[model samples]
Target: MNAILRGVRVIDPLGRLDAPGQDVWIDGGKILAIYHHIDAAGVPVVDLTPPDGVDPCVLCPGFIDLHVHLRQPGDDEAETLETGARAAAAGGFTHMVAMANTTPPIDTPERVAEARLAASNLPVSILQVAALTRGLDGEELVDIRKCVESGAVALGDDGRNSVSPRQLAIALAETAHLSRAVFVHPEDEEMIAQANGTQGSVTRSPIRPVETETRAVNLAVRALSHARSGHLHLQHLSSEGSVASLRRARHQGLAVSAEVTPHHLSMWLPVAEEPDPQALRKVNPPLRGELDRVALVQALREGLIEAVATDHAPHRAAEKSLAYDDAAPGMIGLETALATCITIGGMGGEWLATLVERLTVGPHRILGPASGVPEPRLRIGESATCTLFDPNAEWTVGETPLHSRSRNTPLIGARLRGTVLLTLAGGRVIHQDPARVPIVSEQVTSV
Candidate 1:
């Protein structure tokens, strides 16, 4: 739909549209024009300006998540492409990279193509991350060249840290030639198994240990040291030791980047101690100590962690209802990551606009040369790939589905300050809140 977004704060780093009270014209999947205007003929107008006493909103580059699992072609009961896409749009994401740890595991060209087809119709642009090793067995590398050419944005071996350092070094060396990225699920298997459902030794079942993540981070750093090409991306970093390692690596001039999940920014350890119903807290790396959470937040602020990825893992309620250690790990985050980051991560309005950049440009950098969406110019003739939200609008977590098939988020009853109002991908209205607290438009009606 052709529309004019009026008087909204356009917080774009590219166009220097950080100034508020501007107008944006979107048509034909591109930004037709951007200017200061009160009216335009023959087009609909979206008054992003708040009504009297309502908080103001802003338009920004739609969020780009570097890591997420859509659980399609396999775990539809957990989540499907449709629900995942809706969830992403609802979360203000227009582009996201889907992890390859699926039912059959997106390993081959054919599997990547099939995953692409499944995501093709979604409102969000979903890129597949083909398995780094065959079946994610971590024993042998998949066709790294073929996977990238076949539509995989990047390659990874997530869901477990069972990969051999020698094999992974071989994989990284091979991936260097492809000039893509390798996202490792940062953890050491032996150390974690040794933790045995408890970090401090009063063990019940096997759980992840902080040393496991630190060891994996060190190993990944060493492996990347052997590679002269390709990027090394760390996924869902969970500890202060992990952050310290990545930070030092960046200082040493390595082509490495890391991500922190929303949950890590919010929740602390003693995850296994939580009740079974909320057992989704049982993540692979597991939540860390309070010091770890503080360090992670500091890393985000200091730009040590390059992006905030949802790690948007979804699982069946029944699966999560199982015993804590026996339950599936990961809660849905595409819907709650932003709010969690804003509130739980302690990013208020002072850091608000910058967070949008971390969600958009930061992840864009993580995607690197493989992204299909051109970098934004925040000007006329650019693709109208952006998101809109009311920064001051308050709502309870359960007010909207955010379109996820799963209801596994831990923030269900928590109240949040900001709300995503609309999400546009290529000038099309992909998602909007029907029960949006009414906005007072000047001349045209709101969508």
Candidate 2:
């Protein structure tokens, strides 16, 4: 399987170079050669000739999602490993970390092994986050070593906050000894009771104050202090104050990193109308105020937010239609993430490259196994994991066209700039523009 992606603009965040009119050759799922010029007679090539009169599209490393819910073995109605991987590949993501909140939670090493087996055939890499507690109950700690041995990338109780500080400390201590990171949801139960939406009078729902997140983070940080350089990752940080707390912790030499979601950066409370419970916009660590949104965007530009994750939680429409309090929190995000980064974040080519690195290399460093690393100008002998994007292209998101099993995206009907033209994983085009030519199914294979 030798093919040349010629005449494409290559953006390598690691190399910090954006060179246009280059050729990339991929063979056996690894890049064979990349250069500005290649003789046609020397080797087989496929002209990825740019569209007439249009500049070549950007070719960058595939994205890595730090947080996503691929409800497998339980709630397949919402999403499964296979479907979620397909959606991720189409969205230009080559790897994703699956959360630990599914039914029969990924608490044991056996369960983690099960997930890996289930996802073995997917085109997108699926990394499992083992539960921080047995059954994610926050009472009993799971076997950290066994879970890690079973293929869990990290440990977390994503959907629920660890209720017992003592238990959390023990878990952190054990994970630290094992050289594994712990991801905390960072929500104090008492504060979370009143804090559901942005804190302000504009929204009817009670605001989940900044204190809720900061307080929980403080606890986690304190717990980590007892351990041996335990890496603590704060998930879905939504407040300016939360970011400030993490910043100070890092300045003080704490092993802390954080991620922010697109919705938190893109939307604010106090809409003309209150968000419908069924809108899928209702999410945990609910959307914050405009000021927070602005601060988060600034943090991204300033490199305070280490990664941008979709927190791609999905639920059936019927499930989301419940009352505001009863409806589940989360929305489908894999597909809309890149578009939102371009459209709402007001980021262009260079920043987009950085974001892709953050999604790929940054998370990979934290989780290890080292999948994402900067490449040298798309040279030969490189891994064949790449994303082709049309930055200037525009498209409207609709429920009917989304690949997620759930149609729970708030961006539906929203006009978005930028579209993924093709995604190649292991020298195979898992997704391609159907309008251009019907991609043979034989060319597609699971990751």
Candidate 3:
């Protein structure tokens, strides 16, 4: 349905528009025109103008998450593609990359097609990340060309980066012509095993030490130097050395881009020191200390780290209720990602434009400039995909019900600002929070 967003502040970083009091007209799944005023007699009208018209709600291109775990085709109890898509829309993401570490990993062309079928008609665009290896076993690369043909957006060995550097280089060289990237979860298996081996007992400190990630990053970067053409997209980088290695790689002109998770930026590892297990925070490539988080923020500010991706892994409550050592390593993230970044990581309105760009354009760049996904812009003929948010809106984390099937987030009781009010994909209002948004009217009136 066509809807005219009346008196909304448009934040279009690519178009270089930070204009207030604009009327954005959407029809036929595209932005028809953006004017100073529009009479909304033919369609519905969403009045975003605050009563006083000061510090009003903002409109930007629909958010995009480059990395997410939907757990479809394998674990529906954790999250289905439909539920994950709704959760993404509720979080203001119109598009997200679904990680392929499922029951049967998305490694073959047939599996990729199956995932596409599962994601059919979802609220969010499900761009499947095909596993680098046949089963994410770190050996035997998947048919990159075939998988892409079957609708795979990118390639990765999610949660498994201990693949032999030789094999990774070979796979990269083979798929170089495809122009699709291999997103790596940089973690050394030997280091983790060693960290646990040293502590024979079930209880262990630094299960996955800092060195595990840094060493893997170092190896991946070094190996990337030999790859033919394709870029190496690193996922969920948390350690200080990992950031430094990425920085050095960029300076050296290696085709590499990396993303940092919200949990890594805000929360630290409580499992190591706490007398009681903090199973909720237990994640793969485990969270580090304040020093690591400080460096991550510094790197992000310096433009060394280009994107912030919520490695939105969803696990069942029963699974999360187990002992720290036995409990699952991930929790739901899509619903609370923006607030977590804003409140916990201190990324507020001043950085809104940059934050929007990372979620929209930066992730798109990893797929390639010529990738078919439309650039998020506020121009006539552009797809009318937008996300409306109230930066100052306050709400408790868990109190606001998430759209996801699982409620495994750690930010249950934390109060947060920056709430998503509306999300439109292809001009369709896929998700709208009725509580926070103003009433839509048949007649439009300027504030």
lDDT of 1 by residue, 318-422 (tens): 877887766777788898878788777756567777787778878888777655656744657866777878777777776654568898766676777677877
Provide the global lDDT of candidate 3 against the true structure.
0.77
Q: Model 1 — TM-score against the truth?
A: 0.90
Residue 201 displacement in candidate 1 (angstroms): 20
- Tell me how far candidate 3 lies from the true structure as C-alpha RMSD in angstroms: 4.3
What TM-score does each of the candidates earn? 0.90, 0.88, 0.90
Worst 10 residues of 3 by lDDT: 438-447
> How many residue-pair clashes does candidate 3 contain?
0
- The alpha-carbon lDDT assigned to residue 150 of candidate 1 equals 87
**Candidate 1, which segments miss by more than 4 Å at Cα?**
27-29, 41-45, 50-55, 197-206, 268-276, 435-447
lDDT of every predicted structure (CA atoms) = 0.77, 0.76, 0.77
Task: List pairs with backbone clashes in candidate 2.
Answer: 31-381, 32-380, 33-380, 122-446, 122-447, 123-447, 195-207, 195-208
Best by lDDT: 3
How accurate locally is residue 340 in candidate 1, as Cα lDDT from 0 to 100? 80
Q: Give the candidates in order of lDDT, highest first.
A: 3, 1, 2
Positional deviation of residue 187's Cα in model 1 after best superposition, in angstroms:
1.0
Alpha-carbon deviation at 186 in model 3, angstroms? 0.6
